[model samples]
Target: MVKQANKPTVWFNADEADILEAFSSAVTSTQLIQLIGPSSQLVIIDEAQQIPDIGKKLKLIYDNRPDIQVIATGSSAFDLQSQTAEPLTGRKKTFQLYPISFGETVKDTSRLEAKRLLDSRLIYGLYPEVLNNPGQEKEILIEIAQSYLYKDVLQLDSIRKPSHIEKLLKALAFQVGSEVSYHELAQTIGNIDTATVEKYLDLLEKAFVIFKLPAFNRNLRNEIKKGKKYYFYDNGIRNVLINNFTFPEMRQDKGALWENFLISERLKFNAYQSRFVNTYFWRTHDKAEIDYLEETDGILYAYEFKWKDQKVRFPASFLQSYPEHQTAVVTRQNFEGFLGA
Candidate 1:
């Protein structure tokens, strides 16, 4: 039988100075058990990566106390995953929580209102604080970009110079919709090798700041295979990296911003609803391209994102190769359905 919901729950934040001190001393399983009393039905440990040997400690609790449910959360994937991978292999189930999604905003208000705020969403993004505080988006984004964005990556021993990561992020920010080359990035961020650039990119990805879209090239000889494009998990973060918070109408990269917004929101939409799909960008060496592609259950879906309502024609080469596919152009006027709202 499961524990009833009426029982008490215990919460601990390993980042808090007092909690850190207490956890640092509670080394043994017995000591840890004493710290978390038997009366609690649930134990929640936030910033669990800060606790030493967290995985083994969690395993011990699971082994000893069969009644009490435990939840451990960490902001940084690299630290948390590394610490927990070995000890709590089968004992844990992980879930990723992204920034607030378009569907969620619609739930809070009406779909019409969500559409009305589309420009603001594109400029300021949908982070909880940014959404809650209407006019303070710029200051909040600046703080997040400078203070918390690289907090985890900078702490790693492998990252000796922080400037390289900053430069790499700026370069990625500038090339949001375009294919990125490691050699070119290395040349741009002087004194850094291609290997380090790749490493920093990986770290940023693991940290959930950005995601990569690989080229789809299973069919055509002209399709570019060895190409990758990066998009931020949030548009505001990308803008803050390059210090561009211009309104959508005034910006030159409105199309890129729109593409990033659609892709990221679509990511959150698919994730929340458990729609499993493999994603990519389609491009040919000769410059014909489709902005985004998704393959699900062996069916291809191609999408082209436009900031304004416009007719778009997908590449003929791609259509000929993948004949049995769905295609659509997602525009500002009809983007609500694209984001699963």
Candidate 2:
């Protein structure tokens, strides 16, 4: 979009001291115009959440300079949304950029090539840097996981103990593809309360580090309603958190990694295609479970992700209760269609 925009486009990265100073001092639309130059037809502010009164400033620009287009990008969503929500309510369009998806890789390369790298992707993940740097995925993932992943979460005033957040993240990483309990997480992290666990988890989610999938329950009394499973936005980050980059064949948690990879990629697929769907994992107290569920247009779809070609049978109880549904098992051999590739 930036490349296709008009000439004389001004790009301001808020991370730079001078750029931050200029934006911080631009109190009015006229001042902002002068700072950005009146000749500029498009303006882009990266790390926009770092600038104070950004929403109002953007609003001023929109109201005064109808000729210029302004684009704001920020990594810390909680900060960005809170600052921009009210002032830019009717003035802005928001977009989320996720890690590289299977569909994108297939588009860039071919479905055959993407399929060939499935095992590597499962272990190293689909992060752009990791994907681009084939041999140095472990090192890059380690750097991202350690230095960049928790940058936003650590900056929040609500976060008092940073160590607890790391421990909690490690715990969640280990338990991927399984139900998570805040109380159990609290105990696992030690010295943390369930409320703090929940709060940190919420912050992590806002930071796009992890996402929660709640139990799918409707008419069935035996369905586990309050249960939730948390999956990382990127499998690389999850694997780095646990310090595991072992090949899928050598890893004991290959099943978990496969589930995490498919679900995360599916999430990116659904979002990119603008599919409005509710996602969940279904499990009953009696141990009948479906790996993943998507409800769209009043129709339920159940999916089971497997690393190997294996017989998968959707619990009879689930089939009987939700008769109007579709089911499929996604394996490496047949996952391209499932991921919209």
Candidate 3:
């Protein structure tokens, strides 16, 4: 729930706080006003997607009552928007509260503790239950997918078939941080069009399940026109779906996944920390690719993610073009320095 300045943070702790079930069958403004308590300023409805005509209802509430701040919390807002996008136009503010951010896991936790928890996050994912009791991982994951993931997908026309969606998710889990071809994905899941594939992927994005990063488009459009990369919101979720939750040392692709996950976490950190910046990945036709390209004002920050501590060589062509850009090596040995800097 979004924090309301008028109300105390903890409802139960406050003397004036009164949490009422604002859910109502009120069709008119009079009925809507009657549902909410007179003193109530902040309205928080959990599982808001369950409400019938959610978007229209929200818009009505927001429009009718300017005094009350409506903050509807739902794991799947996609359904609400699908029901009616116009009803809630320019009224509600959408904020994504993911399972748990990478920064959250390591905030107060010791480095050793963080590493210990990473394996569980890698496999079962950072979904509340799996992060809590990792033993019942498979059960929790399947339940989460069936309960929340399926509910929205089933409602969407693009993904009428649940089995195909599951198969697509499983296939994409292995291809984390890699460009996904819609045509190839459709072919793998039997008969489906590329547009359908794109639509299904969009549904996932809308639900905050996965994030797709478009290839950076500069004047060199041919270099980036090929394919866009897809990444799971949580590294743990990605690992779990792929069935590759081996120990860091034993897992060959662990480094790659970790790097990918860290990049996302860092991006999250920047956003949450209120830093103004943009992200990109620069690549040339000759196969020269820079992992991350961040631009703040006219200044550019280029990063290369590698597991090894060995030296990295930036392309001479890139230096000739953007000599002012800052380049750095992020590896096991130097990552701490990068973070500190």
lDDT of 2 by residue, 286-317 (tens): 99999999999889999999888999989999
Which residue pairs show backbone clashes in model 2?
none
lDDT of each residue in 159-269, candidate 1, tens digit only? 788898889999999999999999999999999999988988888888889999999989788889899999999999988888888889999999889999999999998
Estimate the Cα RMSD of every predicted model relative to the unseen true structure: 2.5, 1.7, 4.7
Model 1 regions more than 4 Å off: 1-6
Those runs of model 2 whose alpha carbons end farther than 4 Å from true positions after fitting are 1-7
In the range 185-247, model 3's lDDT, one tens digit per residue, is 999987788888888888788777777766665545445555577777777666656666676
lDDT of each: 0.88, 0.89, 0.67
lDDT-sorted candidate list, best first? 2, 1, 3
Could you estimate the TM-score for every candidate? 0.96, 0.96, 0.83
Number of colliding residue pairs in each model: 0, 0, 1
lDDT of 2 at 248: 90
lDDT of 2: 0.89
> Model 2 Cα displacement at 161 (Å)?
1.1
